[model samples]
Structure formats: C-alpha cells, structure tokens
Target: MIIDESLPGKEECVGSLKNILDALYVLNGKWKLALILCLVQSSKRFNEIQNEITGISSKILAKELKDLELNDFIKRNVYPTTPVSIIYEATEYALTLKNVIGELSAWGEQHREKVKQSMRKQS
Candidate 1:
C-alpha cells in the first residue's frame, strides 16, 4: 500500500470507520448472530431459544438476550397467563441486518468448504 495522504474526505472515511466499529461492537459475540437466526423464524420462549441453540448456557443466553433488547435488535414480551410467559422476537429494526446476515452465511459456507479442501490436501 502506497501512502496517499492527499485523498479527499479523509475525515469522512474516519467517521465511516468509526460507524463500522460501533456496529461491530454491538454485534460482536459468538452467540448474537446465532440467537438472531433462531428468532428470525418466530417468537420463542426462553427455554425454547436455549434448547434451539446448542452449547449456549442459560446465563449467557439471558445476557445476550438483554444485550439484543438494549440494541433494539429484539423485543421481549411478557404475557399474563397461569404462568407468566416471556417471549423473544426479532424487531423490525433487526430486519435491517437481513442482507448482512445473508452475506455472512454465504461467506461462511464458502470458507468452510475452503478449509475442508485444505485439510484434505494436508491428508
């Protein structure tokens, strides 16, 4: 990479970079995407979500759910019933991430195949 300090709107580029970092900071976690994927299908109870995502602890799921709610990615609903029922559902704001999630899923599948091919060559 050659040095090019005379570029236009360098400050704007910096701001855009900051925006990207901020978004990543909110979504940065092993579980957030998985949890979002689960909720995309339909609203689910806490235990249903916990059961759907393997290897996620109840404590971590609870924390991630709270984080998602805070970020407006999901809505938590409480229904009055014989036993208080709490459900988690994706917010319309979260649908803004649909393209990003789709692209990531595509890239992940490609990466998995690439890694498998490399492993086969090693063998």
Candidate 2:
C-alpha cells in the first residue's frame, strides 16, 4: 500500500514500506529463517543441520544454505581433515536477527493460542 505524497506521514510510510520489502526480499522463504535459527544456536555439519530442521530435504537445505551464505548470513568453514570436514556457522550478521527471531517465536505461540481459542468458540 503506497501512501500518497500529500499524506502527512507519507515519507515515513514509504520508507517503512521500502525497508520491509527489502527485508522480505532477503528473508522470504520458509527455511531461511529456520535454518538461521538452528545455526545461531551452534554450528553444525550438513547432515546435522538437515536432521535438526526436520522435513527439510538435503537438496533444499543445500540451496537454502547457499542462499544464506550468499546473503552473508552464514559462513561455510572448511577444515583440513581426512574426509574434508566442513561446518556451517551463523555469521555475526546473523546474530542481529536474534531479537527478531525471538519476537516471531513469541508471536507464533500467541497466534497459535488465539487460533485455538477461536476454534473452540466456533464449536
């Protein structure tokens, strides 16, 4: 919803709209945030991440990881080892989303309860 130029708070509204669109452009997927949340707790190998974030197939996880890495939200570290061990870690930039993630989690719980209550009332 783009506000008209004559509106009192048009500048703020347009700025906010642009900012939100930019954020959504970067974080517009089901798995990106979840993957980031998982790694933010601790770095892990490919399979480990796949296991922790259930229902995310290895193929999709790989793609999501690539996207996160490209966005500088995660780091892919390669260790010198017999089988070439590698781990995915959340970058410092990713930590900035901690509060956002927390808020979303809390909101999700609240929304779930609200939905449940609404359903109960309907019956």
Candidate 3:
C-alpha cells in the first residue's frame, strides 16, 4: 500500500495507536456506531435493528440515524408506500469497516475478560 506521509509511520503503528483511535471516533458510543455496522452488512428495517440491538428506544435510534447520516456513515431511505417503510444501509466509507469491526470485537472480548479477571481478583 502507498503509505501517506501524513498518516502514521509503520514503526509508530504498534500499541493502542491512532489508526484504531480514528476508527473508534466513528464507531464509538453504546448504540450509535454498532447500529451503523449492523446495518452495513445489509439493508435492514428500523424495527429489525431495534429488536436486535435491544434497549435502544425509537427516539434514540432516530437520533443515531440522523447523526450517522450527517457523518455520511449511513444512508436512510424511506418508501412512500401506504405504510411508509424505512431502511438503513451503510455508506461506502462505512462499509470499509469489515476488518475494523472484527478487530474491535476481538479487542472488546479480551478487555471484557481482563475486567472479569480483575473483578475476581479484587473479590
């Protein structure tokens, strides 16, 4: 890959670096970023996403959608049918997160275990 000089050098890429930090900025938050990634795999109905995410109120979901749309991470399409259906899909930029999402999930899994171990030790 043609590395950009403005970007971090290969030697500085070790440890908890900014490449991942930049990703977390977009994918951070309890339900906001996760919702975007979940929708990215395929177009999903609003209710479907809500049901899977759990504990996300319709209002919050609506707000998250607006934020993601504003950031160009997601796109919302509404059909003018009798019942008016809405679907959310990830944009090209957001679609670049397949590997990122995997890395985060793995990191989170390890972090969760470390926390559990600490709690056990403290107890």
- C-alpha TM-scores of all predictions: 0.81, 0.84, 0.70
RMSD of 3: 6.5
For candidate 2, the lDDT comes to: 0.93
Model 1 lDDT-worst window of ten:
1-10
Give the candidates in order of TM-score, highest first. Answer: 2, 1, 3
Q: Relative to the unseen true structure, what is the C-alpha lDDT of residue 123 in candidate 3, on a scale of 0 to 100? A: 92
lDDT of 1: 0.92
**In every candidate, how many clashes are there?**
0, 0, 0
Q: Any residue pairs clashing in model 2, and if so which?
A: none
Off by over 4 Å in 2: 1-8, 114-123
Task: Give Cα distance to truth, residue 28, candidate 3, Å.
Answer: 3.8
Q: Taking the tens digit of each residue's C-alpha lDDT, what string does model 2 give over 1-123?
A: 657756658889899999999998888888999999999999999999988989999888999999999999999999999999999999999999999899999998979988798989999
Q: Which predicted model would earn the best lDDT?
A: 2
lDDT of each: 0.92, 0.93, 0.81
Pairwise TM-score winner, candidates 2 and 3: 2
**Candidate 1, 52-104: lDDT as tens digits:** 99999999999999999999999999999879999999999888889989999
lDDT of 3 at 2: 59
